[model samples]
Target: MKNEPLAYRMRPKTIDEVISQAHLVGPKAIIRRMVDTKRLSSMIFYGPPGIGKTSIAQAIAGSTQYKFRQLNAVTNTKKDMQLVVEEAKMSGQVILLLDEIHRLDKAKQDFLLPHLESGKIVLIGATTSNPYHAINPAIRSRTQIFELYPLEEDDIITALKRALADSENGLAEYNPEVSDEAIHHFAMASYGDVRSALNALELAVLSAEQNDDKRQVTLEDAKVCIQKNTFQHDKDGDQHYDVMSAFQKSIRGSDVDAALHYLARLIEAGDLPTIARRLLVISYEDIGLASPGAAARTLSAIEASERLGFPEARIPLSQAVIELCLSPKSNSAITAIDQALSDIRNGKAGLVPKHLKDGHYQGAKELGNAIGYKYPHNYENSYVEQQYLPDTLKNKQYYEPKLTSKSEQKFAEIYNNLKSNKK
Candidate 1:
């Protein structure tokens, strides 16, 4: 018992002790109501690992006084099922805890179905995968599915504090005193996997030498136990947008160091897709015609990132980030589009001129479409005076070229020439 992990020792013995999932185990909750009346049926507890699914199952068995037996689909066989069923028949009913229930073979499922229907066995199937998508429909249909969410930082912190105080089952034997930073680190860095946090806490307490009165667990001690210091990043939250904003602005400002810094931060957060997406936007929005080839080069990098993924994906992402940061910047394309959008939105737009309208359809000539249209290809330098917009919008200008770099200047020269030729 002393050799057992702190997480195993700290398993909530009663539903009330289960801190993370109040909706499932609180007063008048589904599990509570069923357990109080001993009217529990087959259930599937689904969520990510180390989030108290197993603990809740054990808590139910204890409270209901049902014969509890645990098995894994990975190692257990059909014969094992037959034995448990026979014992349940002799001694009333059994509560069977099936781990990785998604992997339950057809033979075992077939044997368990009738037993479940007859109330001889209460099957508690535990799976990390979503039961709806991963579990067989027959199994899902028979079980009440309760989803377990990842434990919040406060809940994990409270659990850790409890473990430190409890002499009977926790780390109290070591007379450990953990720093607040250490405790907080465990709470957040564990990423809602309470078992891993508790295990790390246990190691920190056991390994640290006593400092005068108690084993002082420092932040470094905690980090050593957990292996990595997690930089809190909410990919779907404000921080994600903040970092992205910084990443793009740094590149636009031509601050390569800052851009690379933000890129590194995002990579450590494990959001290559976000970084890739932001980089692609920068290629066009910031680099634009100033470096006309930057967009294509950045796209190639993104494609490589999509294929490689992660640590390797970072290579292409870094290359693109560097290129975009160094390239001359422009927003002419985006500004041009925004101006056109503003015109359309505020009713500045007009219909295509009669001469400019498509006239290839049947009887189009009768309506006078393209009657006076000037064929530009037939004229010198492919130049011809033409009315492309409606009579009300003649000579309206939306794109004014900003030629800063050689590449942009080339486009500006062509635009100027066309404007000069237009009479």
Candidate 2:
């Protein structure tokens, strides 16, 4: 029996079989039109790993019935490019799929540019990085870049079903009995990478102990093969920033479920420092005056996590996450500070009023420091409104407490009473 992996064997043989990327491969799509007319062009495929960049290129070549070749930008040299060009010169045309094109060196790129310009070799550059930021501008300008999104679970499940049933180039000959739980596990845990799903499925079917002369793939086997496929999230990459952004926004939006989901993802990856820093920031920036005690609570939780790190840290971290997510939120503290900062940065600052300046020292009285200062303890409610701000800034109010949260509402009432006392 041929021992090719299912991912390789299940490569889409036709455009119709290419899963996901409906915007590119669906009916009357631009790529579909290009293949149908055999009017191939130099293009770049950009997205996460294993979203079928190579498979789509292959499908396009198969549909067009054109000569196809593939090379890795990391391994292929200028000499290899020359060899492909030599062959294409005889064939009159060829479709070249260059994997990790972001890694294309200057020499290989310079050699390929002319061929791409002359239409002798249709270059399909695939990269996991953003081409605009990673690829040479000249090469990027020469090719139409199509971004392939990660495959959704539904798209991956459909592909898995096809692989399970196909008689040729699939496991139909072995008659594998894959449970629905196994299928769901594979579909969801692949983390939007169909290639990962197929490979794990194939491995589970081939490696499992056979029962009744048929391979049986269980949920445990699927998990063992792909190990939850929790997405290779780079802690310092764009995804990390995105997760942090979502985490904060979820808390602000009061979506406890989403907040907890992001919390678990971060915790699972052992990103405790960011989690620690982000939790404190959210408590102040989001919860703010709405829940004044939340900051202390969040800090207590973080301190607990610090005392016991990692696997145990997540418990206290989760506790803080749930409380913050469910808490009332306010931005008054941030608004007050930002407004004060804006004034200090601009020309709105002034000298402290004489009455508000230090008068405790003996000479301070001689400078008229406490000359007009009112002693509020003698008054009813023990509160008096005098010119606490500088003469120029007497009307400048920085802290405008909102009523969105209970603490802020209490502050509003106190402010109103103070204003009444002033009148």
Candidate 3:
């Protein structure tokens, strides 16, 4: 315990001491409710690293008198789980914190399922990977899933100050002088990872030159300790999808600043392909009919981005994102197609009208195909009102133009005119 890192040593002994994640451990929260009622169940905690997944598990265990054990799913063998099981048998119940639970192999999972069912092990599984996608279904089905959020800057600062004041498990014994600038640097540079911030604070304090009896830590010391910023982006993780969703949503919601912000994050990740595809989809799906030309321009921008690649590609993408954010939005086209698809899927489709059927065959007239088909080209304005849909669906209407922009308003007028003529 004396040689353990500051982060491990400063682990909260109770739920109340855990920093941030009030949503989970708050008094009225579900986990706290479970603790209060002593109705513990197997659950999985998932999010980015250094976000109190293990700490929350420990706190929950500490809140109860049950035996607590910790193990890594990857590093620990099945035999390690057996040891916990043996202890559970003796103690009646054990709270087991399994780290990297997404990597739990089938063998270990098979061994744990029966115990999980028997209520002998109240498993608290923690993983940076999303449990739904990464964990085996057998284990996932038997556990409640909760997502942990990153610690805010204030939360990190609060934890850091607490660590400095904690003498027993923290750095209060050093009596080092830490500047506010240094603390701010640690809070910002670590990017919501309190563990990284605390360890860096420890490094700065331990390695700094002593000013008589006190070592004064500075922003320069904080910078050297945390050499690289942890921005917390995983290409295959939830953050990637989250950013992509926000990017399109911002554009649809017509917030240029927000759209650009998410675009910048995607650009920073160098995800040109995903950006290009999402932009193309947004052009038609969100801005359809209202600004048809914008969709064409977005296509050109995507082509330019693909040809130019990243860095330079960001220029075109940024321009396109700005234009899209400002573009008038409509989803009429997508809505119309989806409605038609739904009807077809639900067996609403009927036989094609005989007059609209192909009449090029030699025996077409005998079968009544195209017998009464009046060519619209021969009529005034290349328009004629006649039944095009099958007799059963002759009254079906799908495309209802959302008169959002001038272009869509014009389309709506024409559509209404044709519908009137049909009646």
Candidate 4:
């Protein structure tokens, strides 16, 4: 029993036996429709970890008359894929299920593309990443993509109850009774991962029996089991959102230490490299010129992460967070641009003045486009008097620099000089 994995022992054998995923099992659902009509398409299931993608694939095969073959993208090679294709050809109607399909490299993905397109095999690929981005477009185009959302709290509760009461593979022998409060606690902690909830329930039941309290599994028992097991991160769901929210808020609030802590959380949780890179873009877009170097430093960290990968790349991320938090905060430049755009959108479609229309000033003695545009680089103290703004907005000010540090002081001076010269 110790040698056997819990997932293997409790694997759902039939569509009726499976828990959660009612959206796919509901009346008139695609899977149900296919099962009824005896017609299944080459498709992909995209979802978070432990969300029943593989279980549903197996159930589909079990429910249908087609011969089923399983392949793991992590271990199966191009040769294995070809052999499967050949077998599928002989079998007439065969369903080939590929687990962790995103792990397959470009060459392996390309090798399967032709077979997928030709419908030599009914393919069911499962991934924890977004198939649109992770899968080869050619292969993905041939397969219908179905998104499996994380289990809701109520769905998780139902799954937990089913696992506890099922005689074949659950804790039926112990007849353990779990409280509603305890179930709620476990569901919340599971972060919408049914597998995690089941595992935790199984461990708690075992622990209760070990402690001579086999009649019931309480919140205390559940807590003990959770504490004993390593806190696993749910990368594609709730935990991911929770940690990222903390990270972004920490940066916005200028708490460098807290920001770094969240960064570490994401890295330790095995977040995708592209996702980490995207956070850098947020650093620039939201925390921009306020910290002039924040965007640049974040971009540099992104590049380093791409080159060096995790564990080692976290150092640059930490550095960027600290620098951003310490740097002066300002969004005036962004605000100015956004406000101008808003004005344009609000029907402020002011046309170009006759004097500045087209290239009318290209050869004019009044300096044309260059006229009224101050040459600050060629004036007293590198400053010049000019009327550069459109006449309608001649006195309007947009960017109001903050006096956070010496850099901002210089920016303020330049802004003032430009405004003074315009008068």
| TM-score, one value per model | 0.63, 0.79, 0.89, 0.62
lDDT of candidate model 4 versus the reference: 0.74
Candidate 3, residues 1-423, lDDT tens digits: the string is 258888888888888888888888987999989888888999999999988898898888888777889999999999999999999998788999999999999999999999999999999999988787899989989999999998999999999999989989888888889999999999998878988999999999889888888888998999999866467778898889989999999999999999999998888778888998999999999999999999899989999989999889988999999999999999999999999999999999999988889999899999998889899899989988788887777899999899789999999999998899888
Error of 1 at 297 (Å): 6.7
Worst 10 residues of 3 by lDDT: 226-235
Off by over 4 Å in 4: 1-4, 179-181, 210-215, 227-332, 335-423
Q: Between 2 and 4, whose lDDT is larger?
A: 2
What tens-digit string does per-residue lDDT give for candidate 2 at 1-423?
558888999999889889999999999999999988888889999887778999999998888888889999998888888988999999888999999898898888888889999999999999877787789999999999998988988899998999989899888888999999999899899888888999998889889888999999888998898876458577855567778999999989989889999999898778889999999999999899899999999999999999999899988988898899888888988998999889888987898888878888889988988778888897877877787767787777778877887788999898777766655
Cα distance off (Å), candidate 4, residue 147: 2.1
The Cα local distance difference test for each model comes to: 0.88, 0.88, 0.90, 0.74
Better of 1 and 4 by lDDT: 1
Q: Which pairs clash inside model 1?
A: none
Give Cα distance to truth, residue 36, candidate 2, Å: 2.7
lDDT, candidate 1, 114-206, per-residue tens:
999998999999987667777899888999999888899999999999999999999887889899999999998887889989999998998
Which model, 3 or 4, shows the larger TM-score?
3
